[model samples]
Target: MFFFKKFFKKKKQPVDSQQTTDRQSVQSVSKIDKIGKGKSQTSRGLIKSNKLFMAWNKNAEEKKQRQKSGLVADSYLKQISPKKGFTFHSDYFEVGDGVAQILTIVPTKNADRQLPPFWVTRMLPRGLGQNVTARLIQPISTKTEKWTKDNEVKADAAVRQAYGERKVNDPSNQDIAFQVQDMHQINEDLRGGQYHGSEYKILLKAPDVETLDSAREQYKLRLKNNFRGLTVEVFEGQQKDDFENLLKSADAQIGHEKKMYTSQELAGGYYLMSKGIDDITGKYVGVSEGDFNNPAMLMDVDDWSRNIVVASKFGPRTGSYSTEVFGDHLRSISLWGVKIAEDAMIQNHRVVHFILNNTDIEDIGKRKIGADLSKHTSNINMGKGAINPFEAFGREEDKLNVYPTLTEKLRLMFKEMSPSLNDVDLNKYFTQLLKEFMEDKGLWKPNAKENIDTISLVGLPHNEYPLLSDFSLYLSTIFTIYQKQGNQQAIKSLEKIQGVVDRMKEENGDIFDKHTSSVVDNAQTIPQVIYDFASISERGRGIAMAQFINTLGYATQNLHRGDVVIIHGVDQLAPEVKEFVKDNLQKLTRRDVRIAYLYDNVMSAINDKDFNDLTSADYTLFSAMSSDELEAYKETMKATIPSALENSLISKDDLLYYLSRDREKVLFKLDLIL
Candidate 1:
């Protein structure tokens, strides 16, 4: 019974004649519609939907067609194929028989010391074993508008955050007081504009890859030791392409690696004009013989190098040293006892180079050396074992150990000749002997009295002639003692001693006056007379060199518009000498003279006040510093940097990085030469 009921339920019931006919027609029509629409039909004549399935099948067919055409499989490969502007090249190239690679030197970010670009070059190596060339490509200075705007934006945001909303009715403005102060401080620190971005490139060359690699490592090590804050990187691969593009136009809109620096920074130590190569505009000064007077000779060609007069404070002396004299008689000039202890060199139409030691001891020691007299006096003897004159003279009595026993013996002889002489008479004879000794030693000059009067009338300080002043004081003491004695002969003898002191002073004052003029004049004509004054001590040589500079400074006050004077190796000069040169520099520049002063190990002198002023320059070039100098310089850097920067605590390293990155900071001029 259950089976029959299920069968009956599943079976279709018979209908009335007209209705059944209509239903069959409807079913037939539905089936036709399903076939046309791509739908599947069921066994019971019911319609089924499969639209999603059909659409998916269509997509699959399209994908198959694309794969067959090779479009889908190779799409990623197309992206990596060689393009129009991409190429690979090594940074190194073969030049003659060796390989050369160009590298870039940049200041390290947040470095404690912003080492100069030239310093990197110097660190690379020098001499015949190592060959490297550096090219400094400086673009215009970097623009500060973006950095300024960024600061303004940050400041505005900070203000907004601090004050979000303030009501007029608020009891006090204390809530944002710290913020206001910070803002004000920030404004103060950000007052100045920033300028930076200079590019330094170096070319390294070696005979083989191994040697080149070794040199590269050595250079890196040197940089680390000498300039810990510097960064060196090879300019290779795509970097070269970018650099080339930058060279074409530093301000181009396209991608590039160019950095902009001011003209002054670029010109600081760059050989802008290669002497003869760039000396086309001026009169021929002849090829530089790389002599001490090269600059003098070249500058003489200009009209400004003549008619120089001594500075008023230096006394009424005229310039006797002429560049023309140096040029006309290059071989005949007599150096006239001029010698320099420090390493200094001057090249015509080139830069002056000086190597100054960092130690004060060396400077003092150099000044103390008077001459090499052992050669002349070594073999000489007071006939057969006679007591040595210098030995007989008590070193304690001769404070400077300057007088010999012969001098004392001579004084005694004079006293003996006057048997009835009193103490006053003995004093007179001793003074006369002293004067004669001074004359024999070339410390006394015939015009000593005239020079003395000149110096006294000008009110010059006694320190200018320290040794002479000491002698004069001794004589004056004796003169005072005999003043009451009324000893006329003693008075005369004491006066002669005064004359001796005056003569020595006069010689020092006039050392440059006649010696420089004579040397410059006869340098070209009488080369043999170019006496090194070897008999003079190193101290004497130092003194003479200082005087030479003094004379040149005063003598060439009215240099022509384009005249250039190069003063090198001044670090070893005495404090007084440096001051004198500094004053003379002003005199030289008062007209149109351009002065180039060269110094080495300048970092050591930066802490010294006198040297600080000396280093002040329109343009400056620098090299690597010693480790000791670097350590000392760090303290200076710490003091120089601002305490805070951009709402953050700033370290000395940060300040130096900022200064180097943005050269126009208060600590650095926009045109500073690195």
Candidate 2:
């Protein structure tokens, strides 16, 4: 059935059919190219399929139309082709988006005589690129002639008013009593009047414009009353540069931006918002903004949103008063003390976050970005008026009493605090203290023995007890003790104190002599001496006391010569044994002694010298005897040569020779005894 199925199956299609299918596909491609003006070769098939080409063409046409109409939206543009003056434009449209294009025209021909014209332009909507032209206008020329005529009438009016008031309110009777003609005559007389009294002649002489003008008016009034022939030559000064003065006043006013808020005004305003103005035309063009909301804003303004906006606007320019409009968007936010203290922790974190996010702050030139952020954080956390726990001790008295400033204190605190040890490391504290002692207090000379001693006294104990190192009271007590008796005793006393510390140098030459040792080189010799004294005071005391007691035991035995007081072992002696013996004995027969044969074994191993030495009455060696030997010795009071010698006081060499003389005979006796 499988063979029949394989035979009946249709054969595969021929290569000619496949070639014909390929040719047909090629023909279809050629037909498509011909239909589209042969643009198919230039066009991407995939791009066409996705309709990206159509979109591109549509955008291209729109951009071309926009360019031709000069209506590119929200983009700054300048007419580069016609470079006569800058066509200023701005692209700012939305709440926070704007671009101002400024063109500076520098007069190359005459830099000093001709001022450069500044052109500024702005764009509004996102797609509008309309260029607006703005030109700097020169100030009007200063001229006295223009000022004189302009103010003449006002001056005349002022002169008439002054005269009328003076005449009406005349305090002197002579001023009131004088006729108008007489007043004019007096005015004329004063201008070129002859001296009547020689002594008082012309003490001061100057024409009072008000008085002269007033006299002229009074003279005119007198003439109307038929008082004629009253001729007066009034000297009138040229009209002052009143117009120029007016212009000057106007210029001064224009040059300066009036302060919007005084202290009282600021208090009442409830909110403050400041904006930077264009210098050329005093108009609000830019607002300063801070990256972080200022804490101060909450206290300054009652309305939270308004206060935030005002703070955001003005805080960035807190330290700056520049003609340039661009400044930090967020600078500072000042809050009331209570509010600030309450929110200090959160605000500090906010400031840190703001600084971290601000690209402009990161781009600052003088300080690293991380460093600036750290400084900002520190300011927010520990700055003046900040309620930070780390700075809680910064009261006025503490400030005065603290030898170091706050910065130094903080530095020392940071250096001494150890997160690893779960406590502050006092080694650093003592090191800082030693440094301060030398530098600030001038207590120690460089490399002086006293300085070294002081350091050792302070450093070693601090190493042992790090917790106590930073305690000023503890340090004071130690210093007091050191100052009174010097560091030697303190150093000696500290040797017994135990704590974790770096390995110390071995002082005595015995153990450390074998290795190439840093202790021998770096360790101070004086400290070693103090350590030796301390060691003697501690360990040596016990040994000495035991020796004293042993000495007393031997002395007691000597006093009762017939009686034996047996010490089983040298190792078993008490600390005071030697001292006991020295205090009581007239003389000790042997400097050293050992005891033997306790508990069926030798209590102490004694060499021939020591054994023979004990034969003297001052010392005794006790040994257990076998029951049989004891019985035999009790019956026979025989004294053999060896036994007699063993019992008697003999030279060490003589005792050795006697014991060695007949080893085999001794062995036979030892075997019989066993």
Candidate 3:
């Protein structure tokens, strides 16, 4: 009770100018005495009232505590006290049960409507650790008008905040204009589509405060390790109550909460454990946990059917990843593919899922791809690494370095990865890494022309490398932090890498040019590059192909040894990116990174040069296919496929797919959630 009083105590307000000593002297002595007597009497009565209120509150709190501890469930209602069972502490909530505590996730910044697979993968239980269950509560629907109004309010607030923050440091309007433009684009996107906004809350329950604290710290570090832009901090004080309310309501709007997401990003994780379609009745059904355990939940429609049904508890299925078992309530397979593919393994091989669609340059490509890539740049692992690329060339351990070497070291540590470049010339790669890092830190002015010139020299297709791109982002973050602290080491680091690169180029001469011809100069204007993909001439498909292969030369650099890179929308990617994927199909498998490409255009994949290569897959699944595409696919694989499947009609009754790719090519009908 005393603790609660302290927790809820209000701060003292400033004394009124009229009540100050100088002004009080003007009052008569008798008047001052009368005022003091009146004040004393009022104070005594107020104190009595306060005491009664405190006593009432204390009693109510005790009852709530008892209910939360399970000592007393409501006699009439027989329900747990959802509203009263938790008390907010400094940074977490303490349950009345005393043993359990709750912590909610606070994102570092707002996330996109479509979250990338990499971001989704990092959220698995493995990343969250043991004894912690993450409950993601998202709204399934909302009225469009309310959604628009809410978003507009958020956008206005965001703009005002950005303007205020920028005004102090930057007199120039350029930064503010950019912020306004971004907000405008976001507003337009929110207002244009069937997009429903969502709030993300990861409710983590732990056995005790000590365990909760440890798990929270580890989870935060892991978040920083895996994700670039958005990690999470634990919700503090009243925020715990807000998050709890969110869990109970799911779709209810919480006042003044700044973070909002679109359904596209959050809905991918939606799943339901319901029975498959009924054979006799042809009806799909969902059973409650109690009903599932009871025999009467199942109905008998056939003759000579058993009257009784038996049910028993069983452990959840094993070896199957979340993606395989994602139940049939999804809006986008591509979104879910990214959501679930990270944790999947097939026959001891890591699986990478890629969804490919042809990029229509005039339409979605020019607008969406750039924005998408920008979103992913920070979503990918661009934080902390093992090596400090910015460290001065040669400083003795005892000598005081000009910069914070330790900070740089931590920042340079490539997201949960060892500093293994895998056949890449580390020197050359880091040189590029440093240049981009300097640009990010604002130490070097960004030069689009310089980038183009370099790309031209290296061959346009060879321009963008994933490893350098990610590492540069990481270094940029590190250098920016140091720069804010008034350190000039970023400048020195940039000079060092640039100097080394220049000298190397001088030494190598014309031999340094991997490809002599400049695709940018010769090839047609390339439109949009997604996921930080290098811009290249669309006409230079051949060049893009060459670059794609060149990029794969460093596949080992980008992908972890056991990574399953599930890439979706490969076709939407620029030619260079697509070609990189195409040429490296076999090479990626060799690096122990298994990749699965999902093409909406089945014929496109079938006609691909690597179509024969795909036949080597352990399983090829065909789902929701157009008649023509199915026929073409069947005809293309007829030699390897079984004769029975040629005549069998695939139906969507169970959302069934024809699975083939075994050596015998035996056709197997399978039901899948996607």
Candidate 4:
């Protein structure tokens, strides 16, 4: 009966045909309308309807489940898994498209200690399943040197060789043999040496416990046999401390030796200049051959070579040393003497004088007395216009006093007599004085006084005599020729010696009254003698005056007259000063030296201003920049232009422009331009 029902019964009877036809007609009309309007069926609409039905069914199921579980229909699980086989509880899948699944996995026993933390939802395959079910076994300490049959034979040979036929009784030999038997049980120790010998020690470290035990035994054996002669010292750690101590000791020894040798060499000493003074027959002296061998000495070549030896020859007088004589000579030695003295002073020594006059006293007295004073006294005693001897000597003294009454006159006489008194002459004069003084012992005899007086008159060495002599000869020759020619003009022009006297007065400011007055009087009178002998022009006379002015050290001041000198006529002036003088030569010709002076003053001002402006501008520019920037600017400027020099003048603006341009260009090249 159930089968018949299943086969024959219609599923359900259709509704009225007219009504269904009406419904189909309605659907067809709707489709036709939709097609006519270009509108088509939307999958979104179907999906929305399907989604609604599914959502409703899911809600119903969720409600049923909630009824059972007492949870809300819109719970988190329901939202995540809406359908069967897609439930959040079964698979636990992440719901959102972009959500990442994070699993916190705790470590388990049997996991490899080296493995990183694991993740249940891993990005990569878990490697080898965490190395589980495996255990690390402690390694057995095997014999480091395996004793194979052949190895054993070699070891036996080594032991025999090292033990040197080991005796059974000697304990040391037995110990050494035992050490040799275990060939691999030896350690190497290397050390450094002092002097010529080598001391060896070594350091070793073990990587494992087995290696550590083996190394210990080996070290013991090595100390017994291989290093038998060496002292075995154990070092447990770093050897840097020992090495540093050794290096310090070595350095100390080396420094000590170096210091010792240096001190020794310093103390040994060496010559600084030439070896001085071979003999002490006289006094210690420093003499130059030039002075002693001067041509004016009139001595034979051999004598002249030894002529002016300035020995520390001592006279009978106390403090009568050659140094004093030399010093006096150095001082009064004329212009050349003054120069030499100045040079000596610069070399750090002072000079004094001890001059010995060798003039004939009787001749000097006779010359003073004019005609024979002895004959005059004899005649007076014979009753021929009687004159007292005292009066005669008095007249002689007065006459002697009349000729250039000044110390310079006495100095001049000594200078003239200098060349005559060489070492031999001085020695002879001293010997004579000693003889005279000895004869009149304890009584100051007048003759003894004379002898001592002659020796006492020490002055500047006559060493500079030639210069004075040449000067005198030149003047005398000029005077003699002029007088013979009677050329008053030449004489007058050349004879203006007062110029020199005035210059001397200007320089010294009347320090020596007698000398100054005598020189001035002589100068005034000599021009008359020259004028009578030669006739010279005004320009010649001016040149002579200029020369005289130079001799008195006032050439520059006097010729320029404290104004512009128009040094165009003088080649000796500095070129720059000369140029200034020449540039204003026309003004000088206008007899208005003030114009030249003004030009000089203006030039000085301009130069000073130029220098100041350039310095200030440079300082400003340099100070404005850092050291590196200043250096860079200088390099750039140097590369762009020629060197700046004193002779070259550039306007301040132009220089600044150059410097600025260079700075800008360099900065721009370095990308530092602001």
Model 1, 455-478: lDDT tens per residue? 121112222322434445666776
lDDT score for residue 588 of model 1: 45
lDDT per residue (tens digit) for residues 259-311 in model 3: 44444334444442233222363211122121111111121111111010101
Question: What C-alpha lDDT do the candidate models reach, one value each?
Answer: 0.37, 0.24, 0.38, 0.25
lDDT of 4 at 326: 32
Q: Tell me the tens digit of each residue's lDDT in model 2 across 610-632.
A: 22232222212112233343233
On the 0 to 100 scale, the lDDT of residue 209 in model 4 is 31
Q: What is the lDDT, from 0 to 100, of the residue 509 in candidate 4?
A: 24
Candidates ranked by TM-score, best first? 3, 1, 2, 4
CA deviation > 4 Å runs, candidate 1: 1-550, 553-558, 608-615, 631-674
- lDDT (Cα, tens digit) per residue for candidate 4, span 5-51: 00112123246665333364345445444544545547776565556
TM-score comparison, 3 vs 4, better candidate: 3
Error of 1 at 132 (Å): 15
- Give the clash count for model 3: 21
Point out the worst 10-residue segment of candidate 4 by lDDT. Answer: 665-674
Q: lDDT (0-100) at residue 470 of candidate 3? A: 44
Of candidate 1, the 10-residue stretch with the lowest lDDT total is: 1-10
